[model samples]
Target: MPMLKYLIIILNDASVSFCHYESAKTGKKEAGMISYDNLNKAVAFALKNNLKVNFLYPRFRPGKKYEKLIEDVEHVKIVPRKLGGVYSDAITVLEAGDLRKENKVTGTENIILRLSSPELKILPAAVKEIARKGGRINLVIKDVENFGDSKISEYRKLLAEISGLLIKKSGENSIPEVNFLTDRLMLESMNNCDAGITHLTVAPDGRLYLCPAFYYESGENSIGEIRNEINIKNRQLLELKYSPVCRICDAYQCRRCVFLNWKLTGELNTPSRQQCRMSHAEREASGNMLEELKKKNFKGAKGIEIKKLGYDDPFEIAVKNRYSIQEFKNFNS
Candidate 1:
């Protein structure tokens, strides 16, 4: 297995979600805090493995005792916007409703903006706000599982408008780092989540999970206990080469969330239509933005190219261009 580079420690069952899945609504009984003993073991495990830790915080503080344990290591904090005043340096998550209030955002803070399909209409304005007051904005569509043909079309149109705004911002020398658009411009290869591949999660139960989403789904999904050797069944399925569509895809910035894959398609390596179409929409919008930037002679846009694709969904391409067994073996070799 590949060496783990990062470990996500979910501080509590009620931890605020900074990603697609909601931690508070997992329907699981409150498992309370990760015991101080397990917490120490987790930290020791991380230190021994030379892994970077990311502490996910809940709405309320974890108290001074937990705070002290967290401060012992150099780590990143992912917290909800409600606690932004407390952990000011943390990567803060703001839901669609949060944007309605008068929230103060410093231009140096990394923000994760979570939105559903209906809330996507506010994205353009949100982008403008972030460009004016934040560092980077990671847009996480909360209901990606519900994205259909019509919603995907609407998302594409919104992305086009967002691309135009980003182009304008670039010309003004104040380009905001919107992950959906800006990330695709610079990524040359697959920059996916790679949950079980590059990083793993340690839930409050002191067990290892592929990622936080898996742990939230079920403790039964844990690969192993944090104190034991990590073992992930069918682990190769998490790699890029094992993915039929993703291996040949160029949506380099797509999260390729494996949890969503298993939930929607019943396979770890296969992606749902919603995921593929949405990623390609971002890729297409990025390509258009890159062209506009090049046309405007934006110096920073030099050397980046997002090529055009014939289809929005990679499954369509994969179906039409199926590889033979020998071809697959050669490709992997």
Candidate 2:
């Protein structure tokens, strides 16, 4: 049985689906909200499967009925920062294009900032402001595939600058965690967002998918419908142990988005070069930050070790050493 923990429900077909790949919301608007009957069934399916639901909202407000149905169960709601209230307590997700330094994001406790590669370079000022506001930040790169090895220094510099700003703003208070850099410090093994393995998504069409991206990208992307049994063929592809390179890699904070794997290499188990290198760079930066934090008397990072690696992409090293599938298991053993 799949150890399913979360069910991401895209409330409408038009909901903002931001990540490392292209936007799931295709051009010109269309009526995309799922029928009330379908949504109720979806919620029932979640309860049956013992999975927590997470609703992804679009620009418009859901009707009273939809709202009540969503509130009936314990679930998470992800809405655009521009959507204002209704789901004010929900996790606010912002696209880089939508944020300005002057714009005030009302409730700032847990915020997700989405940025493309180019926007990432110019957003230190905005990030500093967010850091000053005192909340947890998840800096998600929508176009991580564009991140090149040459830009590793820039990425590190940005992380260092953000760390400095966050430390300065907090003064003696506990430093709020930064997802990309600091997450690795606290993790001992691969702690990726196990998309298809540990989580599943329900689309507006009432079909279950590996994730929301799969639903919006193509209806055929769905694994099964709500009324039918939840089916994920060859489910092992979603597990980390099934991945040759990632299984041995120590970059515990890498998202390891399976959708990106399918998008970049047309294989669910393989990862792209950009994904590996960027994750390694973050890993290296986190290691440095861990050492720096230990010096500042942050004992939580004590005894953490992230060895210096010559290759940013583990696949290169594995290939160079002629590592086979059995060799990966032996290395970890």
Candidate 3:
């Protein structure tokens, strides 16, 4: 049975896609938006299946017909900051270009700061400012695979600094939610993006995809069409528990992005060194932050603990143990 919890409707071909995988190479074409007929069908699908809709917007204002179609559904609007109405939506995603604008952090119940590694190093103050306004911050690093040694060090130091900032900003009583660092502290099980498992994307082509990146990167690779049923071949592979390394790993906050996995390792279940190491660093940072929060006697944070691990990458440990993927299945079983 397909547990389709989210219906990610891409309004146009040029809609703002995911921050990391959607590079300049995947620029806009003149292909146009999803047909109003397809939009209505998708919305009907969401309503019939009880799935929440997340509408990805284009840079320009949509026409009245399209706007009216969008208004028919109770969906979350995902728009670029320049398009305005960031304050009213359930979530706001910041592209790297959005950071170039003037600092004006006033919007939404949640804000996703999508930055490259270099951008994150200088973004602590901005993150703190955003937190001051009381909206949750989800910091998404676009270029995770390209993190050199210096960049890795900078990431560690930055997390430490931001953890303290969050502590101070929330005072002694509260813990402000910062996805990169603080999310791991509270997560007990894998709280990954769960792309194909819990969510699916519908591109302007009226095709169903695993996620937005799959559609944005290549529409020809669609799993199914909106007019018919969704056909996710070997769909079990998309779940976290089916992942050999991820099932045993305790880095719960890792997005385990299926798109990133397929992009780097040629398999949706297998993760790259960059993903594992960066996630472990954040996990360790969360551990340290949790300890400090406990020391301050913060409620609900007292019993939380992220264990210390020797190796950052789980693949290295598997190699050391001479462990095969099959061994992981048996071990986890």
Q: For all the candidates, what are their Cα RMSDs to the real structure?
A: 2.5, 2.8, 2.9
Q: Can you give the TM-score per candidate against the true fold?
A: 0.93, 0.90, 0.90
lDDT of each: 0.83, 0.75, 0.76
| Candidate 2: residue 15 Cα off by (Å) | 0.9
Cα-lDDT of candidate 2: 0.75
Best by TM-score: 1
lDDT of 2 by residue, 1-333 (tens): 247787888888777664554444542333578778888988887787777988888877787889899987779888876564566578877776667543543465677778877778655666565666667778788876777766666887887777666555533325666788767877877777788777888887877889877776788988887754556798877887677678768999998989888988898888998889889888888777666676676766546688888888999866666657666566431
Candidate 1: stretches off by over 4 Å: 25-31, 103-108, 171-174, 324-333
| Model 3 spans > 4 angstroms off | 23-31, 320-333
Best candidate per lDDT, number? 1
Candidate 1 clashes between residue pairs 3 or more apart in a chain or in different chains: none
Clash count of each predicted structure = 0, 0, 0
| Candidate 2: regions farther than 4 A off | 21-30, 101-106, 167-173, 322-333
| Cα lDDT for residue 118, candidate 2 | 74
